[model samples]
Structures are given as structure tokens and as C-alpha cells.
Target: MNLLSKFATVGGATLVSRIFGFVREMLMASALGIGPVADAFNLAFRFPNLFRRFFAEGAMNSAFVPLFSKALEEKGEAAARDFATQVFSFLTVVLFALTVPAIIFMPFLVRTVIAPGLNVCIDEAALQQALSCEDRFGITVAFSRIMFPYLASMSLVAMVGGILNAYRRFFAAAAAPALLNVVLIGVLVWALWDGQDTRALGFAMSWGVLVAGVAQFVMVTVAMRMAGFSVALRRPRWTPDLKRLLVLAGPAALIGGITQINLFVGQAIASFKPGAVSILTYADRPYQLPLGMVGVAIGVVLLPELSRALKGGRLDEAQHTQNRSLEFALFLTLPAAVALFIIPEPIIRIIYERGAFTPSTTAAVAAVLGIYALGLPAFVMIRVFTPGYFAREDTRRPMMVTMASAGANTVLSVALFYVMAEQGIALATSLAGWLNALLLFHGLYSRNLWIVDRSLVKRCCLLLLCAALMGGVLLLLMPLLSHWIQPGAGIGVQVLAIGILVAAAVASYFALCFVTGAADRQMISRMLAARRKRGARNA
Candidate 1:
């Protein structure tokens, strides 16, 4: 498949998954708003998700995709499959070992790292009246243990997903995450409809996570089998390939862990403030939609493509891929950042300020969302640039850069939390994101790995201009349409108003892109045409 086609496949599937995720978050907000239950659930969810980055999405994919793609290209399918099996066996053994200890030490983790604020609040009578903080802490620990096994299952899914993506079978791998959201939504709906209390709902959601993990793993494993690459568990062997993978994977895992630690710091700090954890999570959801669709889609496609190109000694192709990936990433992400910054209040109010979620909560979450918006482009660019290092099998430098970013995040988050509260934590994350992106870009440039050309620069500048214009339009229109997006407005009206505003923003941005000649309409048309012809041939 062509680059755009592969990106569309992954991006389109991811868009679906993110939409379901939005629904899942919306339901959770309505059912459990920013209360003790919501805080507990988010804290528990964060545990596995933090490790998911380290084990599944970030570290594992970074190390596995390039090497597996190389094996497939160089030796043959049998050799690649054998290597995959060996890795799979080793990964399963390690994850199984890790999960047991993590589950056993869940309380210690919650006390020291995940939610220290809970212990402090357990003595506050007022907080106890709302929901017993001691009980909530216990629930958080139990929920975390229940959800910890998901890390193992999802890590295996990531391995199979890497195999599929390396072979250009992107659809099933990309779509697997949607199943988790779907499962969560069902569990939440049932819990809400049954009039279950908050604690029961939280417990149900934790179990839902385990069920969904199993389902996702099954779905991707089926896809791998369909692609004629069934990687089954075998006796653990210390092969040279496996050892090299571990070497690369160790640093990548640390890099991913560092990024998650930044989040951990934010959450741990936010935990001290009532409802701040859920507020930050709610704010984080909207920006994640664009980030997942653009940044993740581009990164997933770019890594293996770059590896194959560079391995084949195709420098120009690799360069073009890098440039286009960055251009495409910014093309989608810049406007998203602008919209989030410009209309955060209306967006948060319309989507989340209902049921138990209040106007005060909306305002707080909006502030956090706006701060996070400032870093959206930086976050996307980091994803686009990091593949340059990973595809070249260089993980140590990125890990070092992440270390610096984590240090900055820690200092800033601690310093800012006392001053600006939760918004400060969000702002600190944004600043750290920019620092991380700049450092990654500098590393690539210093190594002569990334070459920025004129066309890429011009397009990026035009994209910024278009986004600025879109932001202006949004700022101007928001006041006029404020009543329809207010917390008291009817939900249907709010949805319609937000939809119209978003549609206008998207239309105007694309129109400006066309007018400025920054976007190549003919080139896009040709790509679509080529995709169609290829589809016909396959048929």
C-alpha cells in the first residue's frame, strides 16, 4: 500500500476508536463526574495504561517493528516468524513474572506512587462524607490489581500488531483498541442502568478492562493468523536476535517509562487536589483524539517504512517519507490545537457538563484543556521526529532526551502545582513537551538524520497561518454562540452548535490551505485515484 493509504487505514481506524473512547469518557463523566469514584477509577486505569506505553505501544513497537521488518525483508517469512515466536515467548514470560509482583504490591504502589493524596485525605471528615477516602483508596488498589493483567495481554497484542503493520496489514491492528472502548461503554451503561453505586461501578469497569484486553488480544491474534504469521509461545530461548531486541527494548522501555513518569508526576500531584485527577483526564481526552489520529497514525506507518527504505539504501525515499509525515501530521494537528485553545470552555461544557458534572468542573477542565492545547503541535511533532531515531536502531539518545524532559516536567509540575493548581500541571506538561520535541529535533539534525527542506518549511508556515486564522474566527464566533453552548442549554442544541462551529473551523482552514497553495489538491486527488486503482486490481 502507498503511504497515504496506509496512514488513512490506520488513522481512520484510530478515529473510530477515539470516537468510541470519547463516548466512553462522556458516559464516565456523566455517571461519576469528578468525584471520588471517578478519581479512583482514573487512578486505577492510569496504572495499566502507564505500563501499556512502556510494554505495548511505545517501547515494544519501537524496538520490534524495525527489526521484524528487516528480518522479513532479509531472511524470509519463516525466519521472521521464528524470531517473532522467540520474542513472544520471552515477552510472555517476563510480563507474567512482572504482573504477579505488581498485583501483590498494588497497595504499596498506590500509597507511594500512584495516589499518595488518598492517604492524606482519608482523615478529612468532609471528604469522607462525600465518599470515604479510605474506602476509595482500597478500591483503587483492588481495581489496579484487577487491571494489571491487561498489560500482559495488550503487550502481546502489540507484538502481533507490530508483525501485522510490518507486513502492511494495518486495519485489524489499528482497530483493536476500539474493542476496549466498546466493552467499557457496555459495562458502564449496564452499571448505570442497574443503579449500581459508585464503588460497584468502579469495580465493574476494572473487570471490563480485563475482559477487553482478552478480546483485543484475540482479535489481533486472529488477524496475525489470517496474515499467515502465527506467533505461538514456545520454550524461552536466549537467541542472538532476542538479546539484541532486549537491548534495544530496554532503553525504549525506559524512554516510554520516563514519559509516563511525567504523567505520573502530574497525576500524583493532582491527586492531592479534590477532583483534579478526573478533571485533568477529562481535559486530556479531547486533545488525545487529534493526537491519536494524526501523531499515532503517522508514527505507526513511518517506522517500518523508514526502516525498510533505509535498510534498502534508499535515502531519498526515506527523506521524502519523513518530510511528508511531518507535513501531514502538522496539517491535521495545528488546527486541532487552535480549536482546543480557542473553544475549550464550550467544548468541555457541551461534552461533559451534564448529569453529575457541574459548571464549576467545566470551567476548571476548560482551563486545563486550553493549556494542553498549546502543546498539541509539539506533541505531534515529537511523534513524527522520534521515528528517525528508532528506525535507525538508536534508542539511547531518545531515552536521554526523555530523561531531560522528565526532569523538567518534575520540577515544573512540583513548582507550578502550588501556584496554579491543576492548570499548572497541564502547563508544565506542555512546556516539557516543547522541550522534548526541540531536543529530539536537535538530536536528529545533529546526527544528519533529518533534513528539513524548503517545501516542508513553507507548508508548515502556511499551516500555522491557517490555524491562526481559524483560531481568530473561533474566538470571534464563540461569544455570539455562547448561549447555545452554555451548561444550561439543551443537549441537542449544544451538540448542534458545537458541530456547526467545528465544521466552520475545518472548512475555513482547508479553504485557506487551498488558496495559499500550501496543500496540493491535485496531488491528493492523484493519491485517491491511485488507491482506487490499486483496490480494483486487488479485487
Candidate 2:
């Protein structure tokens, strides 16, 4: 499939999943807004999710796909299947072993990494302004213990999903996360029906994560079978394949872990402020939508394509593919960044400002979301650029870049906390994202790994022009529509106004793109054609 078509296929399904996810979040927010209950829930949920991002999103994918793709190219399907078997045997044993220690020592780890967040970090004066919520370490501990082993299930899913994706079976892997939202929504609804406190509901969510993992694994396993891959477990093997996977995964882990560890820094710092972790979680909702749909979809799909191209000594094709992917991302993601930065209040008000999510909560979350939007493009660009290295089987270099970015993230997060209040934690993350992108892009350019080809530069200029026009319209219309778009107003109004703003931005962007000829109708038409072909295949 062409770039835009691939993105749309994944992005459209992803968008559906995200919309459902937003529903789940809305229910969770209303049922357990940023109180002690919400704090505990977010903490418990994040335990697995943090690791999920580390393994599924980066470490495993970075290491596995290139090698798997190479094996397929060099030795055909049978050889690739053997390689996958060796890798899976080793992975299952290691992760299963990890579960035992994880279950046993999880409490201490929770106390160490998360205990610091169980209470307010603010001083006496700030306490008066902070959200009213109890300090319930008892509830936190109970929920955390019930939840932490979900990691074992998640680890299994990540390994299996990686294999499926490597086999050019992305639908199952991409659709896996939707199961988590499904499980959580079901559990939360059941809890409400049973009239349970959110603390119990939080435990339900954790177990739900386990269930979701199993369900996800089953789905991918079935998909693999349809594609003629197998699930027969074999004796744990120590082989060359295992060694190679580990070597690649280790560096990818360090590179990816930088991002995760940065979150720990934010959680550590934000923990001092009551409800800050929850606020960060709230802000991330909108940020994650675009990030998931385009940024992650491209990263997930791009590496293998790039790896195949580069391994075959098709540098020109690899470069061409990279430019097209960058163009595809720029066309969609820049406008999303602007929309998030400009319209966070409407989104926050619509989706979250119910029950315990008060006016003050809305304002706080909107500020953080707005700040996060500042780095949205950077976040997408990282996905767009980093694949160039991963496709070439270069993992160690991204680690160096991530380390520098993480260091910057930590320092800025600390400095900004006092200067801009707790929400500055999100701002710091946003800045780190941009800084990381700049460093990666520059590093890639310096090594001549990524040439700023003419088309990419032209597309970049077009994106800037489009962004300027979109921003102008938002600035003009936002004030005129403020009364109708009040953040504390009804959900319908907030939804309506935000919808209008988004439509305006999209329409303005398209009109400008057409006028500037950043890309022509034929290019878009190709994507539409590809989308139809994909749809027919799925049908």
C-alpha cells in the first residue's frame, strides 16, 4: 500500500478505537475523577502501560522486525518461521520467569517508585488550592498488588504481537490495544452496577488488563494461524537467534526506556503535587490520539519496509519512502498539533468535566493538554525519523539521542515545576519531545543517513504555511466563539464547538495545500485507491 493509504487503514481503525477509548476514559473520569481513587487507578493502570510502551512499542519491535524481515527476504517463509520459533521460546521463558519475581517484589517496588506520590507534594498554602482528595495508601497498595502481575500477560502479548507484525500481519497487533479499553469499560460498568467504590473498581481494571492481554494474544494467535504461523510451544532454546534478538533488543530497550524513564521523572516530580499524576494522565488523552493514529502506525509499519529496502541496497527507494512518510505525517499531524494546542479546553470540558472533574480540574487539565500539544509535531517527527535508523538496524545511536533528550526532560521538568506549576511537567515533556526530534533529525542529516531531499523541504514549507493559516483562523474565530465554547459548559456545546474548530482547521489546511500544490490531487487519489484495495482485502 502507498503511505497515505497505509496510514488511513491503520489510522481509521485506530481512530475508531481511540473514540471508544475516549468513551472509556469519560466513564472513568466521571466515575473516578482525579481523586485519591482516580490517582490510585491511574497509578495501578500505568504500571503495566509504562512497561507496555517500553517493550511492545519500541524494544521488541526495533529488535525483531528488521532481523525477521531479513530472514524472510534471505531464506523465505520456512526460515523466518524457524527464527520466530527460537525467539518466541526464549522470550516466553524469560517473561514467565519475570512474572514470579514481579509478583513477589511488586509491593516494595510500588512503595519505592509510587509511594512518593500517595500524598500531596505541595506546601500548606498550595494545599488550600489543591483538589480535595483523601490520602489512601491502603487503597493504593491493595489495588497495586492486584494489578502488577498484569505485566506478565502484557509481556507475552508484546512478544507474540511482535512476531505477528513481523510476518506482515499488523491488523491483530494494531487492534490489540482496543481490547484493554474493552475490558476496562466492561469492568467499570460492572462496578458501577454493583455500587462499588472506585478502589475495588481499580482492582477490577487491573485484572481486566490481564484478561485483555489474554484476549489480545488469542486474537493475534488466530490471525497468525490464518497466515499459517503456529502456537505450538517448544522446549526453551538457547541459540544464535536468541542471542541476536537480545543484542538488538537491549539497545532498543535503552533507547525506548529513556522515554519511559522520563515519565518516571515526571511521576516522581508530579507526585509531590496532589492530583498531578492524574492531571498528566488527563492531558495525555488528546495527545495520544494523534500519536497513536499516525505516529505509531507509521513507526510500526515503516521499519520493516525500510529494513527490506536498505538490506537489499535500495538506498534510493529507502530515501524515497522516508520522504513520502514524512510528507504523509506532516500533512495530518501538524494540523492535529494546532487543534490540540488551541482547543484543549473544549475537549477537556466535553469529555472530562463531569462529576468529580470540576471546573478547576478542567482548567488544570486543559493547560497541561495545551502544553502537550506544543510537542505533538515533535512526537510525530520522532516516529517519522527514527525509523530511518531502525530500518538500517542501527539501535545504539537512538539511545545516545534519547539519553540527551531524557537529561533535558529531567532538568526542564524540575525547573518548570516551580516556575509554571505542576502542569509544567507536561510542558517539560513536550520540550523534551521536540529536543529529541531536533537531535535525531540533525544527527541523521549529519551522518548523511537522512538527506533533506527537495520534496521533503517543499512539503515542510507547505506544512508551515498551512499551520500559519490554520492558526490565524483559530485565533480569529476562537474569541468570537468563546461564549459558545466555554470550558465549563455542557458537553454538547463543547463537542460542537470543538468539532467546528477541527473542521475549520482541516478545511483550511486542505485548501492551502491545494493552492500551494504541496502535493497534487493525483497523490491523494493514489492513497484513496490504495485505501479501497485494502478495504476490499479486509472484506
Model 2 alpha-carbon drift over 4 Å, by segment: 119-135, 257-259, 487-489, 533-539
Query: Cα deviation of 477 in candidate 2 (Å)?
Result: 1.2
lDDT of 1: 0.88
By how many angstroms RMSD does model 1 differ from the true structure?
A: 1.6
The worst-scoring run of ten residues by lDDT in candidate 1 lies at: 121-130
TM-score for each of the candidates: 0.97, 0.94
Candidate 2 local lDDT, 242-276, one digit each (tens): 78778778767666555556666787777666678
In model 2, what lDDT does residue 171 have?
73
Model 1: residues >4 Å from true position, as ranges? 122-129, 257-259, 534-539
Error of 2 at 216 (Å): 0.9
Candidate 2 lDDT trough over 10 residues, lowest sum: 124-133
